[model samples]
Target chain A: MKFGVIVFPGSNCDHDAYHVISKHVGQPVEFIWHKETDLSGYDAVIVPGGFSYGDYLRCGALAKFSPVMAAVKEFAAQGKFVFGICNGFQILCEAGLLPGALIRNKNLHFICKHVNLKVENSNTPYTSEIAEGEVLSIPIAHAEGNYVCDDETFHQLEENGQIVFRYCDENGEVTDEANPNGARSNIAGICNQDRNVLGMMPHPERACEVLLGSDDGRNIFRSLTKAIAAHG
Target chain B: MKAKVYVTLKPSVLDPQGKAIHHSVELLGFEKIADIRQGKYFEIALDATLSDAEARETAEKIAKDVLANPVIEDYRVEISN
Candidate 1:
């Protein structure tokens, strides 16, 4: 199976994702430029982290209108895997592939550190290999990582098992203190109702190697690859 | 004609930057402040061929779709010479 990593104008982590997918996930991957509109050959698409459109107007607002985003939207509608990390997560939300919006961090700080995340749901393809309640040490670096939505939408996400990962402590306890950003309900990641599109603030691409700090991030990619291969 | 747009966060969304500014003002001895919120302002120049009503409609559409995210913000449009 082939994987595609999208490269926006300001995307700095495109190569990182490409390397991880090739070396760690043992998959063939290519860097897809922002202007590219075709995605038929790739089994999954990854939107790597970085400030797209220089994060103008809002974090992901401008990038949502990019030419490739229209294709990404249609890809998600076909139940293909689309994973967005950090700014990519913001872009997915802005593009309406996912629900809610990411706002400025509550403390108004560009926090960069390794935070623990509890797997809230493992049924989705992104987290199928991870056991529910498993805590992953993943790094998050962003100034606007706070996620917010209205009450009704929040309820539907809750009722649909769409919540995939939640900020938590070492022992897997969800708490405000563990929430690096003031995201409602300590949400760290979520999937669409169909569970095909997944967005998270954590940079899994940066944590794919033990030399870097943790290899826990590999589980997410591993899960996706395994699920895709099994389906074929 | 010139169209002005005002965009502000909805009351339900927290404005951390505005809060920090409020705290700074309190430290500056401005004791009468109840609260503070931050917002954005934009000005658009429209072609004269469009009527005033048409300008309003165009400005409102821009404000709704491009200038503001209705999920967490409210926008107002004003038209003038």
Candidate 2:
């Protein structure tokens, strides 16, 4: 499936996401500028990580107003796939594609490290290839990854099975120590109600190669390919 | 006209940056402080032709829609000529 990577002015990981899709995933991908308002040609759209608009006002706050975001909202409404990583996840949250907001890290420091994430709902399109309760090591780099939401919304997310991944220990145990950024209930990733959109704090693109530390993230792409092929 | 906006996190949500600053303040020997919460301030310029009520309304709308995420923040708008 063809993928389009959304590139805002300060997006640095757009190239990384493009490289992973083309070189590793062997899929055709293109960079779509934030100002462009079209996304009809792509089967999937990826919002890659970076400090869009220099993180002014708040992270991803300024980025939600970019013209492309309107197109993205339309694309997702049509049930098209949308994947967001790290800052991309923040953008999606700010754009209201997903519930909850990422706040400052509990320690008030920028954290960069590899953390284990347990696949919470493997039946979804993004995690179909991953087994439930399986842990994948992925690196996360950010200062505002602390996810928060009101009690009612949190219950809705839980009851609807919208949560896709959660921080866990090596043994696949969900614990406070494994929560690198103090995300609520150790959440690392989540999908929209329709399951067509996903936003995660971990950088799966950066973990697609064994040479770079882990290749476990490749399963996410493989899962998408399988799902699209089987249903499309 | 100038619009001054103040955005702050909701009381229920945690504010790690503000908490860190509070701890630092305590380290500096300041005690008896109840709590601390951090927020953002913005100054927006509007056309002079707009009336006071119109400017306040515009400022409130922007402050609600753009300057803050209502889900997690509370914003106050003050207009000055």
Candidate 3:
């Protein structure tokens, strides 16, 4: 299956996602510019991490209005897979494609390090290859990676099994110290109610290579292709 | 016409920046201050043709839809001129 990586101004990780999808995943991938309004030929779209629009107004706030986002929204509405990583997750939340908002880190500092995450739900297309409760080491880098939602939204997410991943210790235990960003309920990633749109603050592209530290993230890309094949 | 919009974090949301500011205020010997909250301020210039009521409505719309995220922030719009 082919994948498209959306490139916005100040998007530094678009190339990284493109490279991983093309080389490692052995999939045809293209870079979709923010101004482009077409996403007709791709099976999945990846909104990679970076400071889009210099993170003006707020992180992902300005980028949410980009021309490409309209197309991305349309793509998701069609049940096509859409994966948002890091700042891309923030953008998705800002665009209202996903629930909740990412606020400033509780420590008020930019955190850049690898953290352990437990796969909470593996039924979605993105995490199908990952076993439930499996710990994956993924790197997170952002000043506003704290995920927050109102009590009602949180309850809905919980009831729908939309919470896909949670921050956890190496032994797969959820703990406050393991929550690098102070996200509510230690949530690190979540999918929309339909389970087609996934947003996560951790950088999966950065963790796909074994030499880089962990190859655990490869399961996500592999699972995406598998899901596409099944759908076809 | 000119309008001013003020955007602030919702009361239920945590504000780390505001907390830091409160701590700094205490460090400066302002012991009487109980809390501090940070917010965004924007000055918008509107078309001169619009009447006062129209400008106010436009400013409020902008403040609610663009300047502030209703999920995490509350906003108020005031016509400046």
**For model 3, which pairs clash?**
none
Candidate 3 stretches with Cα past 4 Å from truth are none
* Model 2 chain B worst lDDT run, 10 consecutive residues: B63-72
Candidate 3 residue-wise lDDT, A1-232, digit = tens: 7899999999999998998899889989999999999999889999989999998898999898899999999999999999999999999999999999999999999999999999999999989999999999999999999999999999999999999999999999999999988899999999999998999999989889999999888998888889878866
For each candidate in the order shown, give its overall lDDT on alpha carbons.
0.94, 0.92, 0.93
TM-score of each: 0.98, 0.98, 0.99
- Report the C-alpha displacement of residue A13, candidate 1, in angstroms: 1.2
* Sliding window of 10 residues with minimal summed lDDT for model 3 chain A: A223-232
In model 3, how large is the Cα lDDT of residue A12? 92
Candidate 3 local lDDT, residue B73: 98
Residue A151 accuracy (lDDT) in model 2: 88
Better of 1 and 2 by lDDT: 1
From the highest TM-score down, the ranking of the candidates is: 3, 1, 2
Off by over 4 Å in 2: none
List model 3 lDDT by residue over B1-81, tens digit each. Answer: 899899999999999999999999999889789899999999999999999999999999888778898899999888866
Each prediction's DockQ?
Answer: 0.80, 0.84, 0.84
Pick the winner on DockQ between candidates 1 and 2.
2
